[model samples]
Target: MDLQKPAVEPQQPEGCLVVAIRMPVRIVVLVLVVPVRMVWDGLVVVGRFLGDAVLRPLGRALLWLGRVLLVWPLVGLWRYVVVPVGWVLGRLGWVLVVVPVVFLHRYLLAPAGRALVWLARGVGAGLAWAYARVLTPVGHAVLWLVRYLVVVPACWVYEWILAPVGRALAWGARGVGRLLGLLVSGVGVAVYWITRVLLVLPALALWRWVLVPVGRVLAVVAREVGDALGHAWRIAGHLSRAVGRFLATLFRWIFVEPVRWVYRTVLAPLAHVVRDVVLRPAAEAARAVGRTARQALAAARETVRQTRADVRRALFGEPRERDAVPRREPRPLGARTLDSSTTALTKLTKD
Candidate 1:
């Protein structure tokens, strides 16, 4: 029963965390923090003393030299050597420090900067050259082409368009000429036929069939007409005499008596009054107006002449030629007709 009781006994806590918190190693670990801090502080003090002993004197010397002179030789030495050495170290410093850095800057960085500068210059120069040579010339050529091809051709087409009107006019003139020719030919034919029928044939027929009788009748009619004309002449002479006497009586009654009376009584005094009061003043006024108008016209003419002279002086260096009359020769009648027509006329006259 004690064995069974041992097997069934209630256990105390058995976790690894719980067992370690109470162990002896946990106490030793807690005792290690003090010595670790003392060791870390000792190492920091050693590093500070070493840095001050080495760098502080050098920094003070540099500061003293910089205060004394603008040109610091040590600074130059530091820059030329130290910075390059640091850069080499960062790039995994090898056997040759300066040579690799110089080669890298020369072949890579300097060449890259020079190439970028050259490319920018080339682009700028090419753009300027293109603007001056190619682009400007192309723009001028396009403008010239537009003027010559578009504007000039338009003007030429406008001028050529008038050709249609000229052609129409020519066609109209030809049509009118043809119509006139046809009309003239028809009129000439009609006149020729009418002359042949009415004048030539009738004259010939009368001469052949009835010329003697017609001559006798014409002589009798002439004698009768002469007698009738003689009687009419005598009657006309008497009527003219009667009309002249009647007109003379009418003139004496309507005009002559009244004109004579007025001429004696009113005309004499009115003529004197007009001569004194109206005519003399009117003549004087007319003369003054004429003189004023003449003066004004002369002044205007002088002003016009001066203006014309000024215009001529401004426009042309010399005066224009005046009264350039052309001489002409009289044409002879012989030259007025064709030689053939002249020869025919001469032959007809001679014959």
Candidate 2:
């Protein structure tokens, strides 16, 4: 009496048995998530270092006390007294709008576009120098008086009269086509020698005595019936190439060696075990999520270019910089001893 009953095993997936029983409680919550993400990134770097050391120098001392109490007395009452009273009312509004546009571009728009481009380039250089000196020598003296008066008297009346009345009507139509081709070749050579002397000499003596010995006995009985059908077409082409190499070695040992041994033993090792068990761990988790989204878009474009260079150095205060070489202002020690006594009295009046 056989009684054994156990063997069950294969059941797994309750989310893979709750991820293999919470893999050691996710390695003790990844060892307390790295000291709680380093104390929440050290309290977001001490709240961005107390908003960059106490709200950026108390917002640059309230934008330098609102640009020293409202932008330097309205930029010194618009650069010293409303820019010299709007530059004397814009030079009395450009002497009432640019002296009538410089007296209509000096007397009427530049002498009306230079008298309409010098009367259209002096009427196109006086119609191209009257068509090169008086209309090309009055059109070559009216085409030399219509080629010497009316085409040299109509080519001297078509070469004296009409070219000898068209060469006497083409030499009387080639002498009436060589007198009707010598009267139809003398009545076709007198009806071909009167039908080769009445009919063809008794049909050429009855085809040289009856059909030339039947036709050489039907050409020797069609050359012995074409050499007995070329020896029965070369013994049926060597019995159809030995039954086509015995049906191509019985179709390569019955169907190409069991489809090349089941593509070399089962579909090339199940396509290299589904490309090393599923496409190399999904291409290394899509290249670690595209290198953590290109390092968080290069740390958010280097924290928006250090918060726009700390708000343009806290509202334009540290900018100055430009001094290449421009200081001048120092003349008078009696204008350098009166420019060295006018360069020693112009080098003592050029010696």
Candidate 3:
């Protein structure tokens, strides 16, 4: 007998087995879902196309027609006939009502107002002149009398009596202050001499001997340390500057130069292309629409002007030529005979 094991297949996980079993269903679902989605998308596309191409245009046309047929006539009637007639009637009413009022105001109320203003100005001027000439002099005289009677006497008392007393008191205070200051100065000088002999001399000696030497040693050590620190700082600064220079150069090469090149080469050209291809055409189309609208407005204006002219001609008859000479009507025979007899009678009377 052969000592060989039978071949065994690897087992699949439950989840994978379930997936495998449902793959056919998934396939069917995908097949159905794709065609259903396509049909639904097709319907949406057709609906959008029909709405854009047919429904929107029809709606716009209906709106335009309604405006032309109904709204335009109403607007024209209001603007032309009703407004003109109302304006004429308003002018007539204004002439009847406002003219008399204006005339009355100009002739009556305006003159009265002017007279009252003139009178008020004259009265004010008279009062001001009277106050300046008469009242001002009286006030000045009263002030002068009060100063001589009351203020001048008070000033004399203060100057002669109170001022001398105050000066004497100030002099006495200055003399006392000077004496006190001299005494304080002598005491301070003595104290200062004592302290210098006892404390200040010893402190100065210690400072000169011990502190000065120690400070000098510390100064030397600090100077050496400062020199070493300065050298290290110089080396660090040089290294940092070199690193910064390298980084700046690397950044310029990696980012700035490429960005600048792209901006110059690609982005600029693309912007120019978009402007030429899209923006220019859109601008041209907008200009064309504007031109069409302007032409339509101009045509409408010309039609309205012609219509107005026709209406005016119908209402007021044709206008006579400005430069034409007037012609006399032919005389009747009886009128001619009467005119001749009158001329003969005039001649006979002159003879």
Candidate 4:
């Protein structure tokens, strides 16, 4: 029975076929077919949803990108070729305009400016030449007078007189120095001779015989005298200090206090009264006199000013001005001294 049991074919669901099928085999077929159909349907639904949800939008995006790519070539052509040509043409236009302007500036304006500069330079040179022609001689005369009459004379006095005096003084100083040297040498030699012959020999002999006993007696006497002198010196110092202090105190009491009292009592009042009555009145009177003098001076100045205006009108035929000629007075006999002195100074300077 087990060997006779065999596998059975699976049955189709809706096909028109008459076949004997086993129950287990049928159940197996149903299970396999249901799952395969479910998987296929699910794949078809997913494909359709993917087409609607993703592929449509992606296609539209690709179409839009294609249009943009198609437009870019025209824009690139316009930018690279048309705009560059237009820009070049605009720059050429500007260059053409500027070239004419540059030529005009160089050929026309530059020469005009140079001509104006030359004219100004010629005028300035002419003015400078005239100024030099007018002023140079006067300047030379002034310079000549100053150098010859003033500076050269002063330099001559300093160099000739003072230099000789200084040289004589130096020579006299050298002579005096030589005499001093000789005198010092003679005195030094005399002192050396006296020390060697008289002082050294006599002092040595005296030291050998009598100096020891005399020195002892003299030492005792000198010690006593020194003690007495020291005491006397200290007493004198104290007495002198006391006398100075007493004198200071006496002076303060007698002179300073009395003077201060007298100044405060008698002189101060007199000084105040003099200041208030006499000095103040005198100062006020002096101020009034000064004011009156100032007013008179002002009136005199106005009169003189008017007189000068009349004089200028009469003499120079113009009003007084800064550039007017200075007045010269007639010289008396004594005034010739100036010319004489100038001539002497000029001669001295030349010498």
User: Which residues of candidate 4, in runs, are more than 4 Å off?
Assistant: 1-218, 300-351
The TM-score leader among the candidates is 3
- The model with the greater TM-score, 2 or 3, is 3
- Model 4, 263-288: lDDT tens digits are 99999999999999999999999999
lDDT at position 154, candidate 3? 98
lDDT of candidate 4 at residue 12, scale 0 to 100: 45
Top lDDT: which candidate number? 3
What are the per-residue Cα lDDT tens digits for candidate 1 across 1-351? 011112345766555643443444334433443344445545765789878997788888988888667557667767998889897786775546767888999899998999999999999999998899889989999999999889998888767887777888999999999999999999999999999998999899888789977786666556545544444444444554566578779999899999999998999999999999999999999999999999999999999999999998998888768996887877655545443445767668667
Cα error, residue 21 of model 2, in Å, equals 8.8
TM-scores for candidates 1 onward, in order: 0.17, 0.26, 0.31, 0.25
User: Compared with the true structure, what per-residue lDDT tens digits does model 2 show for residues 1-351?
Assistant: 112334678965544534444455445444544454445545776799999999999999999999999999889999999999999999998999898899999999899999999999999998999899999999999999999999999999999999999999999999999999999999999999999988898788777887776675555445434533443334334444455577779999899998999989998999899889889888998999999999999999999999999999999868889879976988656655543646868668667
**Each model's RMSD to truth, in Å?**
75.8, 40.0, 31.4, 70.0
Candidate 3 structure, TM-score to reference: 0.31
Mark the regions of model 3 whose C-alpha exceeds 4 Å error after superposition.
1-216, 321-351
lDDT of 3 by residue, 162-244 (tens): 99999999999999999999999999999999999999999999999999988976665565455444444444445545665
lDDT at position 232, candidate 3: 42
- The collision pairs in model 4 are none
Instruction: Estimate every model's Cα lDDT from 0 to 1.
Output: 0.75, 0.77, 0.81, 0.77
lDDT of 3 at 57: 100
